[model samples]
Target: GGAGGGGGRNRGGPGGGPPKASGKKRHRLASLPPSALLARVERRGGGGSFPVHCVAGGKLLELNQRLALEPRLLYDRPCREGYVAILFPSPDAARQLRSRLLSESEYLRVRGLSAEDLL
Candidate 1:
């Protein structure tokens, strides 16, 4: 059983073009702890990289290898075709993670953005 989430995305509109592939990092996921680093997303055109961390502790079910080849999917269709990894968390871990996640309004408020800003 795999769960979705923990994907990287760009902040600008979809006109920046695709990012070039550079040095890649690999992780061994024999066991995943809560807040474990899953992947690092490097900013296009030379900036700092962002770390993608796991939300819960469990096993890694699958990785979307397609992103390695087509990183643009993350900017184009993040929720559809650009997922980073799939994980199967334990019942307790899943519950805890869900409880801590912010709702849509909560997230927008925390970022000092309104719902219309996302549109």
Candidate 2:
């Protein structure tokens, strides 16, 4: 837990490290443009098993953040092949991820189609 993984908590997870930021703003894109959250949720990837919500804008969207670590789906489940997990801020981000998935060879065939076809 030292630094082997990634994005070490601002001070580590509630145990020991640097003291957590006192007044660091929480990510709140949902309350920001309003449309940002709506767009993010509408994107294909947003419909997945991971949890999502709108965070206000002012705060920069870090690919990795310390708090509000929401649930992520297993890599091998429906998306990410069990490796990559993403927390999307806006629908466009989701769409970008989805487009990435769609354009890639590994995920393309499985992209944009219905479950019935997969069956």
Candidate 3:
């Protein structure tokens, strides 16, 4: 199985906004492989549902309960406090993940986004 770990992002949301809380379990204790379903983020007004997946194979450590309680955080500060879950990958998986991650500039270039666009 592929290495699984890391935080997730909600790429599919209304106006490309952050994901809404699914109100599911706050803690997941099962081992998951890469691309496994971690959580589901649904839009408030029946917009659409997005599934948050595991990046690498690992154990789910914790889910951000705050998102479930205060969904505004997802819009106010999506990158900081709106993260969905924490996963601890195996040692080998961690090393593999580090090798696969793109540099900040490379990621920006690939996404066709400039630093100013983020702000």
Candidate 4:
């Protein structure tokens, strides 16, 4: 299993940035149903669009709905901008799924082991 670590520059602070939305909207994204389409990652330079389908239950759906409104942001900061949608599933499943995932050290240790030995 592949897991993305959450670590980056904080986009919001006293320095000033985009206007923050209400807490109600944030809560909705943090709790999405199963089988929901999270976001479509579009290629830069008009290459193509790739849909980001969600398999897990819990997710932090942070999609920039205003990508169409301000397409320039997509070009300027593709990493920090331009998401089609977002979705989050059940919390219990998310916990179980994460718990089953092997850490970097564990993966390296077991990577070369035979299937029978792994068990």
Candidate 5:
């Protein structure tokens, strides 16, 4: 309805500056296969350029391949700064792979990266 769970934030906190945008909302990634290898992508310039995370099979993170793809994702391999690759799993689980990288990816701390593997 209202851009998922990203709504209803108390903007009048602290100094009472304009309310900082609340975190993102988590949604189910639809249509996937079982145990398939996939990737989650949080493209740059989406907003604050915040961090995004995804996991599969004990953190299916092949830094070299993915790091290059998202120059903005923040992965120097072996370790990431803040928000960069903020997770080992997609902050959730799936039959195969999971990613909070799309418009559906949950917001900051929104929780549960469940994917729909109807295959």
Candidate 6:
């Protein structure tokens, strides 16, 4: 789960240069535990009548009672609207998590995979 792939090159940056090394080390987003929710649960058409929970430090944080009415919004625009929930342990933790996320090519390269492999 270490973020040490793509040969230290930063993708989508100006001139596609190397990622600037921060004073703090960059971690890998994959290092965190997966969400506890089950993805294969039944989905109601109009609205998702499911409970969303966030587990942090042995405590369960129950978020919304139901998901959005149009679940297709999740698939249509994942980055903007698709997330199940977000957990912010602290400001520093959120910052760390943001820094660890991989760029497109980095993610594929880290797993020794390609976009075609996903299909």
Candidate with top lDDT is 3
> Each candidate's TM vs. the true structure?
0.60, 0.21, 0.59, 0.36, 0.19, 0.32
Clashes of each: 0, 12, 5, 2, 10, 0
Off by over 4 Å in 1: 1-29, 103-119
The Cα error of candidate 4 at residue 50, in Å, is 0.7
lDDT of 5 by residue, 1-119 (tens): 22221212111223522122222332322222233323223333342222222234333222233343434323221223212222233334543343334344443234333334111
Q: Which pairs, if any, clash in model 6?
A: none
**Which of the numbered candidates is closest to the native, going by highest TM-score?**
1
Name model 6 segments beyond 4 Å from true.
1-35, 38-66, 91-100, 104-119
Candidate 4 Cα misplacement greater than 4 A, ranges: 1-30, 59-89, 99-119
Q: Which of 5 and 6 is the better model by TM-score?
A: 6
Cα RMSD for predicted model 3: 9.4
What ranking of all candidate models by TM-score puts the best one first?
1, 3, 4, 6, 2, 5
lDDT of 5 at 25: 38
How does residue 34 of candidate 6 score in lDDT?
30
lDDT values for all models: 0.60, 0.29, 0.62, 0.46, 0.29, 0.36
lDDT of 6 by residue, 21-102 (tens): 2222234221223343322222333232332222332112222212234454333333445444443354555566568679
lDDT of 1 by residue, 45-76 (tens): 45555766778987776656676667667655
Residue 5 C-alpha lDDT in model 3: 22
Q: What is the lDDT of residue 32 in candidate 2?
A: 35
